[model samples]
Target: MNTEVVEEKSTKDRTVVRKALTYFVLIALIFISAIMVVFEVYEYRYDYRQMSSLLRNEDDLNAEWGRLLIEQQTFGATAQIGTRAVTQLRMYSPPPSDTVVISLPSTAQQK
Candidate 1:
């Protein structure tokens, strides 16, 4: 009877230890999962901020590109080129009396 009691007590002690270990492992896993979640949230926020900054930069670049395009068109105009030529290069067009016109015969007429 004494030996049976000792055996039962030992079994109960092992069961208690097992339960404690299981609980500890479960709590540790929960803590680790919580930390991972916090890290993920932080990383997500960081990425979002970076993306927003990139978008703003893209918008600025697009606006600059539009301005550049307008400037290009302004500079490439024929009137602007003619004005530059007259002012900078001292060039001018000849009078109508000095101009000459030549007409070429058509292929059918030649044939």
Candidate 2:
């Protein structure tokens, strides 16, 4: 009877220790998972902010692109270029009597 009691007490102590260890491991896993989730949420918020900033920059760049395109159109107009060329570069249109036409002979015609 004494030996049986000692054996049962030892077995009960081992069972208690096992349950405590299992609970400890379970709590540790839950804590680690919570920390990982928090980190992921933080990272997601950071990336979202960065993406929003980039989108704003893209919008600003698009506006600048539109302005540049308008400027290009204004500068590259034929009448504007011709007027500037005449006024700044002292160019003039030739008279009709000074005009000459040149013709290129086609290879098919020669053949």
Candidate 3:
């Protein structure tokens, strides 16, 4: 009976130690998973911020490009070209005597 009691007590102690280790392992796994989740979230947020910053820069550049295009159009409009053509190049309408019409031949008449 004494031996049986000692054996039973040792077995109970081992079972408690096993349960404790299992709980410790579970807690450790949970902690590691939480840390990994936090790291991923942080990295994602950082990447998002970087992407947003790039998008904002792209927007700014697009706006500047649009402004430049508008300025170019304003400066290169037909009215401005007409003025420059008449003033700088001394261009004028063709006189009636200088007018002529040249017609293209049909495809079958090509050289």
Candidate 4:
């Protein structure tokens, strides 16, 4: 009877120790998983910010490109060219009374 009691007590001790070890392992795994989740969230937020900054830069470049196109059109207009020619180069069109026209003979007539 005494030997049986000792063996039973040892088995109970082993059961308790095994249960404690299992609980420790589970807690450790939970902690590691939580840390990984935090890192993933941080990485996602960082990428989002980078993408937003790139989008804003693209928008600014597009706006600048639009403005440059408008400026080019304004400078290249016929009225703008005529005004610049008159003001800068002092050029003018002749009056109809001072103009003359001439017609040339055709190649067939020459042949």
What's the TM-score of every candidate structure? Answer: 0.72, 0.70, 0.64, 0.62
RMSD of 3: 7.5
Global Cα lDDT for candidate 1: 0.97
Tens-digit lDDT string for candidate 2 (31-75): 999999999999999999999999999999999999999988987
TM-score of 2: 0.70
Scored by lDDT, model 4 comes in at 0.97
Residue 67, candidate 1: Cα error in Å is 0.4
Better of 3 and 4 by TM-score: 3
Runs off by more than 4 Å, candidate 1:
79-111
- lDDT of model number 2: 0.97
Provide the global lDDT of candidate 3 against the true structure: 0.97
Ranking by TM-score: 1, 2, 3, 4
